[model samples]
Target: MRIIPREEWGARHGDGRYWTTLPASEVWLHHSVTVAPDTVPPWTDDFEAIRTIERIGAQRFGSVYGFPYTFGITPAGLIFEGHHIAKTGAHTYGHNTIGRAICLVGNYETDEPTELQLDAVAWLLRHGQAQGWWREARLDGGHRDLTATACPGRHAYAAIPRINARATQPIGGGGASPSTGGAQRRYLQEESTMQLQPGKHGQYRSIPDGATRVIVGCPHGQMSARIIWHGPGYPSTHDMDTRWPDFDWVAKDAVHNTIHRLRPWRVPIPEKATGFALYWDYPPVEGHYDDYTGEVSFEF
Candidate 1:
């Protein structure tokens, strides 16, 4: 594996602080969510971008948690060392000690990552596992697998299965097997009956298995909805705000209620997901709070 060490990027070592030894059992993938400059070439290695990310990490989290992640991957598939394996990273909240974080440098929600970037991540995982750096590693997932925000977006997250497959197969050889025994596409829909009282959170309905995509719609009220997935070791939740294109406004009234409309949102299901929880939040409106009651639908 070709890697740019800390010294190569002029990064300084920590102040002799180290994380407690724990078996590295997982690899958590992340996206920087930073916009790249259009002037740069597509496959060119951007060392300056890496430095800027590290500087941002040092400024934002250095005092309390040191650097944020163990490594960063450039758009050209170049890998840069971050906090090193000796120190615990501040990447994944509950599983930091047990997982290694490798962040790809781009916002995947708006753009797709290059093939080289995907291959580099697979190569790193395979190499790390062989060296026993990830002695107990078996599963790999996105940063959102353990958090509330969308650190790794849909495009990047979709590549997780491919990356996992490449990690086990011979380099530059066979690819992942395609799904067989095609099951009929299914959709599960649910509507919210309980009102979302002001200044309170609503209970989440459990998401059934074999669900590939989920579409949630608030039929009558304006509220922020969340799709929380509960995995084996990590649980991630994402709010449906304006960031997602699918989270759009839908007009149903003929002419009476032009200003108020139902908001519909969609999100992809994470792999190895056992179940999911769906909930909504009602923020204050015009300095006053009101109860929101609506129905939600899911497409599996």
Candidate 2:
């Protein structure tokens, strides 16, 4: 029942953000799905993982109020404190004042969280409630529960029932309803990159055949001119600055780690349109590169 203190992991001081009393109301779960290869990595130990998230969160939120989530856990069952329970989190917006975010280490979309990781999460929740860190906090749900995101990924999210069922409280739900909106999901290669020589005629690549809607995830905060996607390769090929009307530009749990996170840009293909590619209409600038080559993908 021991949570590694943030100071031990070198967490920065908060700017007196959402400081709350003990036994907070709700509990939210998440997967770090961290972007930016430079920052996210398999650290030597679980504590290092917290340090890394701290560094990224620091830059994201600001050195003063950087650390986003309230806690972090690795696959090895190690629980590290982020902001103390009383310290309300910057984890989920709107709901920030209400709940604390506990994040699982690996990306759950494709990677499976180990049993040890789940065990640690369940244990932490029970411990928190018993210690008056939260108000009988329940494993409310994954990050996707409170927002629009593929966070806590399918695999980890799918495992929620298993964790809650084993917890002190009786479980009732099995996470969000399983729905893919009818169309089968299709994916572009991961971390694929394209060079945009400013004025050069940008680049184009077709999506999978039946992909009616594509949820494209691009590195956040860089759509200005760098790594911008200008709709389909139709009429004018559009510009990167403005979003295509049809495409639903949904920003995931970003704003904190904009540089490192890949925000989702959901694009719906026109019915009559024959072909499509995430048209990257480069702007007229000197020289800029989108080296997030392997950092691109879509699930439609």
Candidate 3:
């Protein structure tokens, strides 16, 4: 694990900062509000993403002379080491924290992250886990869990589970054993601090116009798994207030009543999306499941 000076990162803003010589754990997941292409020119590769972060951090935090703890950039699966962890960074909620800040290039709305970019993130997280920087005990979360804004767009965050799944799976080496369950166990998504109405049995709600849906498979009882979603209306602005909300009431016979557990869910508000959104909600008590929902406010 080589550390680089922020000054060498290229774009000004935050420099002279330091980062960890190696990661602490295995759970590496990330997001970026604005992502540019690696081949677009301004800087060298997608690493310019980190430098751009420095510029933005400097302007927002009013610190032109300091460097944040750590910064990272991704376009596909390629991870670039930009700064030393010793210098606290101004990125992600704060410059200094337990997790390393990684940003990917591209506006998710207009562009989908390439397999390479996603693979890069998985590698980093796996690397961290191998180093004991992150672990399976901790549930990987999204940027929205910390702040009020949606810095890492839906398209980007939506892919977290897939990325995590990839990282945990063994490729060249031996794959995760059956006992470990490999990548299938770890799933992550960005949650908006805001809260919303809880699901109930036989009740009907409607998803507003535009919404993103993310689905993940959670631990299910013997021989069964389930899916959850925003059956009615958009996700409200209410926070669950706790790590896990109190399980609410719903009919066992709901459309998909078996679906429980709030996995990250995002679905675009398109005519087709509207159909997709309600598909999970039809027939009261059928599509009921506990899952996190949020509104997408970022533009492409």
Best by lDDT: 1
Q: Global lDDT of each model?
A: 0.56, 0.55, 0.40
Model 2 / residue 213 / CA error / Å: 54
Q: Write the per-residue lDDT of candidate 3 for residues 23-45, one digit (tens) a residue.
A: 43322234555556442111223
Model 2 scores a TM of 0.52
For all predicted structures, in order, the TM-scores are 0.52, 0.52, 0.44
| Inter-residue clash pairs, candidate 1 | 192-295
Residue-level lDDT of model 2, residues 1-300, one tens digit each, is 346677655566563275777667778888887531221211223444566677777778776655678888776555678775666667787777778788887678988887656766777777777778777646788888878998889998898888876566433212211121111212322222222232223334444445554443333223322232333334544457754333323222111112222344445555544333333422332342322221223344
Cα shift from native, residue 18, model 2 (Å) = 2.5
Lowest summed-lDDT stretch of 10 residues in model 1? 176-185
lDDT comparison, 1 vs 2, better candidate: 1
Candidate 1 residue lDDT tens string, 212-300: 65554342335566555555432344456733222222222111111123434556666655445455555455543322233443454
Candidate 3 overall lDDT versus native:
0.40
Candidate 2 Cα errors over 4 Å, as ranges:
13-16, 35-43, 169-300
Q: After superposition, how far is residue 236 of candidate 2 from its true place, in Å?
A: 86
The full ranking of all candidates by lDDT, starting with the best, is 1, 2, 3
